[model samples]
Target: MRASLTPTDAPLRARLLALALAVAVLAAVAVVATVRAADRAAEKDRAQPGEPAAHAGEVTLRQPGRLLFRNLAWGPQRDRVSAVPLTATSGPRTSAPRDCLRFHAAAGTGVCLRATGGVVPGHEAVLLDARLRPVRAFPVPGTPTRARVSPSGRLVAWTVFVSGDSYAGGAFSTRTAVYDTRGGTLHSDLERFAVLKDGRRHRAADHNFWGVTFAADDSRFYATLATGGRTYLVAGDLASRTMRTLRENVECPSLSPDGTRVAFKKRVAGASADAPWRLHVLDLRTGRESALAERRSVDDQALWLDDRTLLYALPGDFGADLWSTPTAGGGAPRMAVRSAASPAVTG
Candidate 1:
């Protein structure tokens, strides 16, 4: 009872339906192609080593392998030390290859020595050298906590922590020891300056002393003392055997390469371990203090490329990365290297 459509009208209706279906098909195909391209790009990014993105400003470290070095001002090019095996484990489970000793053109050459013999809780430490090989291996005593060489390459200092049981109860103490490479002897003058909590002279291995570093001339050194329910930075006179408090409530102090400043990390009150700490710089000459940079997470291992440039390790998802910032306070942090920690700037 309905009239039939003409042939021309019928063709037009069919063409419109066909076009709509074609458009829908094309859209689906485009979406699939886009998803595949994205997946490929992600794979490529992962395959690449180091940081996925490059940082602009300062210098770029694109060197391969486990090590990377970028010259900030240029003094002496770093001397590449031969890769030495550190572990006794055999087969495929062996420890990863690490630099036992490294020498910066500015910091001089040093041989990294592993603990040997009947040393309790053996640990590793580095001994500075004026030439290629070390003059002598410095004794770190107890368990080695931290080690560093003087800027002038005259002295090496480290922290040792000993834990044992006492008559009263369980006890623990930290000691700071320094070795004179030229003299080939360990100095005990500062070790005796440490005192017990009861105002008594500390005997061998009594109190805890950490974060030891020597000045340029090796005549003076600084270390952190945690005792009497407080932490303090103490500067020791090697010649006079006198100890003076430099700062309080600070830990992990790193002396600047020029020996004019000290950088340290501090914890804030009412803050948890998840909260970040502040990095502070103290002027040795004027006793003035200033905050160098504020980080969102914990930061340690600070080293000076020069008097004005500072380098430190930042925590990352996989590991730590090296970042550099200006000590004068300008510009954001730029990536110096990736997947490395304990950055000791050479040259």
Candidate 2:
């Protein structure tokens, strides 16, 4: 036996139901808002013009145990990213795009800085597999100049010449970006980092960075920071988002396998960009800079063949030839590979 609801009770029950409906609607709207915000953020991070959007969520890279080397000289006629056996005298070229101006390979992964050189120019950073297939592509702002992948293939960094006038004594500006392959995060233009000059905040609009070389731990990196008409070698902390100037006039720094020294191009007092840059090795712990014996102006970021030797590229009639010298200083430069501008050593 249940008593029927009074008229007042009916009104109260109806009001309660309406209140629940309103609360449900608000909750649904909030969920939708959250999802939309996430989508917008991902869209903002992605670069355009590649077949697949640069941000495709997390994709695991398959790496080989023994990775090969790829320089401009090694790739196939169509594609300049062909993997060449380091020990082989010669190898078959692949059909990958030879448009890669600079490239680096490590940990079964690689990155190629491709350029369409013409009256109307365009650039891209193309991620590649060990077989030299494009895994993903991201549009770059300027002429591709440098590319490097961390030893573990967890990070990739690149630089491009963004702006310059021929009348300005060939002076140029660069933009660099570091991408975390695993995290799917890209830090564009390292100039955003809090820069410290002599342990003080340094601010400038013309700050530029290039030639990033990552440490084995992948937490610390070194690169060239140009600002105020001067260039410096900056040691950067990726986690802290900060950089400290280490030395002056150090450009295109490449870390040694031992991580104790860096091979970099030093600007000579009387020399111009047209001539060879004197290459030097700086002991990170000792602050000792030793000049390499290679007299040829080395324009490319030097690569370490082993702890004992260093490799760099010199402009040649054929194109650019890869040359090697001793890291201990005072060794004649020898041709390691011909027609190659960029060299990457795989661990």
Clash pairs for candidate 2: 75-82, 76-94, 78-96, 79-96, 79-97, 276-297
Best prediction by TM-score: 2
Q: Candidate 1: misplaced stretches above 4 Å? A: 1-98, 101-107, 111-121, 126-135, 138-143, 161-173, 188-190, 194-206, 274-276, 297-299
Query: Tens digits of per-residue lDDT for model 1 on 153-227?
Result: 667666555564111122556666766767776763355664432344434333456667677777887777665
Count the clashes in each prediction: 3, 6
Off by over 4 Å in 2: 1-79, 90-99, 116-121, 165-170
**Tens-digit lDDT track of model 2 for 185-300:** 89988988999999999999889898899999988999998887778999999999999999998988999988999999987877765673798999999999999899767777
Q: What is the C-alpha RMSD of each candidate to the true structure, in Å?
A: 18.0, 16.4
lDDT values of the candidates? Answer: 0.54, 0.75
